[model samples]
Target: MTQTVGKRPAEDMTQVKLNVKWGKETYNDVEVDVSQPPLVFKSQLFALTGVPPDRQKVMIKGALLKDDEWGKSAPKEGMTIMLMGSAEAVPVEAPKNIPKFVEDLPEAEQEHLETKRFGAGLHNLGNTCYMNSTLQCMFAVQPLREALYKKASGAGGDPTGRLVTAIAELFKDLESGGAPFPPYAFLVALRAKFPQFAQQTQGVFAQQDAEECWTNVMYAMREKVKDEDGNPVVDKLFGMRTRLRLKSDESAEEFTEDGMTYTLKVNIEEKTAHVSEGVALGLKEERERSSVAMGRTVVFRGGTSLTALPPFLTLQMMRFFFRRDNGQKAKILKKIPFSLEFDAFEFCSDELKKELEAPRVAYKEAQDREIEAKKLAKKGPGPSAVATASAASGTLTAANAVADVDMKEAAVASTSAPTTSSSTKLSMTGKYELVGVVTHKGRTADSGHYVAWVKQSSDGTWVCFDDDKITVRTEEEVLQLSGGGDWHMAYLLLYRAIMVDMSGAVPAAVSEAAQPAAAMETEGGSSA
Candidate 1:
């Protein structure tokens, strides 16, 4: 004998209702879901009362609701909840699929954009989100995109070539104006590279590691890339090479060690709370028993020297571990706070600190220029002469550059560094801007829903790609994905170096240093 209850559609299964109350006012029914987490719920409340998520305090009876666990707090049928917080800003919807303006964009991005940021989503077939999210996040890297989609290019008959072709085909699909498609070709290319991914688990597609997929993608991209020296361009493109030192406990720097890493593993213990802290702690020294060295028990300390920084750097949160009780891999529910700007100055070796100096100077100068321009804009369009004089004299006005900028009739237009051969080589190492985040919402490594949150490089807008449903989100909501509870914990974070354009003008000293031969072209142009 068998019993069956009627199954609802996938849409209804994902959403639930809550009776919300704020003082004398009450919203008898409101629809929300765990799929997007409580941050979206707060956004919903913000819609109702014009209060921001960060300012609102939501409570059930006397108990307060945290962002990740709001699903558990809701009753099966539905329950009433209380809200407390002042309304700071008027209620407003975020940017939609079609944008309105470039008002809030950075000075460098104040121009017209052809493509909307993260306008398309990928189709998730079964438990294929693990692969989909990783692919979506990898698509955020500009160099990777350029390499894969450069016109009249074909991937040669190599293991990486197939993967490259698959990526290129998928990019075309994502960029095209239409519905999302299943990445069957990408899956085939992936499985061809690693047969284990093709294996069936319980007659279903087995979920694989996102980091492993990312590494394979990186390797494939590197194989297709070549340098002038005819060597692999892996390190120069996206590798984070490190220098390690192996020494006796009593002696310092007795032995040398060097290696390269594409990803940094954030080891978690019950004690650590933040991602940066975990990374700093993970770089600590270790003692091991060795057979070769006279100091049988050697103290090996790994000091990471940033020999080269790729356009994109990826960090993985070591969330899954082998649980002895379950006899299987289990997920970590630790909430590790990440930042929009990540500082890695403490982690860099002495030499790297010096290498990052020039770019830092260029960035500072560019920022100062923006600040001065904004100051002039605030004074209103009276004397464009004074602003032009200031620009020529290289002087910074006594005004701070805030987001509330009015660029109407400004003298100098802000821009980023030129696309020179060495542009990627130099950047502010300490400052890393968050570009893409891949999150998983499940208890085990074997199965779960994976989603990607990608930032639009043109404007500071975030779009969450959950399978085929693409929704724009706020920075407040994206920050909640940093992970504390079981909902959607950020598993991987991708960071890119922060570099500003010098407003279309390169420094005379650096320009001369960058290319001595290019100077001959300038003289020839003058003669002509």
Candidate 2:
């Protein structure tokens, strides 16, 4: 006759009421409706209704229960109610023969239990009394005084006893971490480990053998004193003595074991020392010869056999010599040999002679050209029509025409002149009275506002195109025409002028009547 609220079975629905008391305050008795059958009837009554049937409660509702017991159980109108579902109790199978601690672990993790068991056994063994006893027995030994006394008394003993003593001492020192060991500790260890090694030294007394031993010991000591990578700790402290040879006519050169010819002068007074000047001269000559023969300077200060000179000294010498040379100051070669036969002296003398002769040669060539130009100028106007036209122009004086002719000849001479195998060209052109022109590649317009051409007057005065306007009234400024911005054109023309002027050839001429007086005046002025 009873009907369930839904499709669930009737045993799945239950109603209960809970009477909660907190501290001294008692809450109202509340009905908790649930939807599950009980596992045990008595237990279900206590659990669902939160009241033991055996306990006496103040509230009693049997009359209301009869009104709605066959349907939904409803509490009195003023009372509160809570609804809950009672699900079937899940089964909890007891684990079989498993350790209490391993109940929560998975099967795979449980396998590690055996390993843990073994480790615990080992740990127990380590802490046992027997292990402590064994360690103490191994470390215990006779007192050092007793052992030494027994050994001095010639008591029979093992030779290794000394090793044990030494090892014990080493261990004590290691424990204390005190003073450093002696350098001979390695040798002591080696001798102790291999006693027979010392026997090999007996009956060998040759000087060469002694030297070899010394060398080996030195080398080994050097290695010991070196850093991890084997470079010396102090470079200057570990250098080898070397000899250099210097020749009378050659430069100073380092002597090597390899059979290379060198010109080193040995100082007779000092058997081990070499004359640095002689050595330097020999090396210089050798370098020059080699460079000339090879057509290029050969660098000799580097490679496997040579080390670089100290930078400070090299730099200082470079600065000193270069400044002296450029400044044309007298240089005192203090350390250099002074003998006339010395190669360095001869080289210096030859250089000086050439320098002295250069100006004179240049002067003679210039005089010759000037004489020729003057003769041409005296010819008045040439029979050529261009000469006539030039003569007709008011600008052409007899000296001017002569200067123009000389300039043309000089230009032709420059173009036809033989040159070295360098990629350079030269051109010289000027008349006796006119200025000489040398042109080269001009710079790009963006480079700066400077002309690239240079002009030299008949009198050896030279001015750049940009400045020529102030120097020469009739000088024309030529703009750069090339699009490539190659400055080689200007360079070539300048190079030609330099070559001709250095050759002392005058590209223009002045009247002979004007030459003597001018030269005398210049000489007098110079003398004054």
Q: Tell me model 1's lDDT, rounded to 2 decimals.
A: 0.60
Local accuracy of candidate 2 as per-residue lDDT tens digits, 1-528:
111111234453344444433234344543333332111212223333334323312222332222113234333323432222222345889879967767677674465343321111111111121111111111111122222232323322223333333333333432232222221222233233333322221222111111122223323323333322333221212121122222222323332331211112211122222233333433342222233434554433411111111000000010012244445322112221121011111212232233324433543455564455556667765655445344333221222222212111111111223221121111111111212222222222111122222222224333332211112222323223211243322111111101112211222222332221121111000110
lDDT of 1 by residue, 327-392 (tens): 988998888888876766567767656755665676566566556667776777657846654673
| Displacement of the residue 496 alpha carbon in candidate 2, Å | 5.1
TM-score of each: 0.64, 0.14
Deviation (Å) of 183 in candidate 2? 84
lDDT of each: 0.60, 0.25
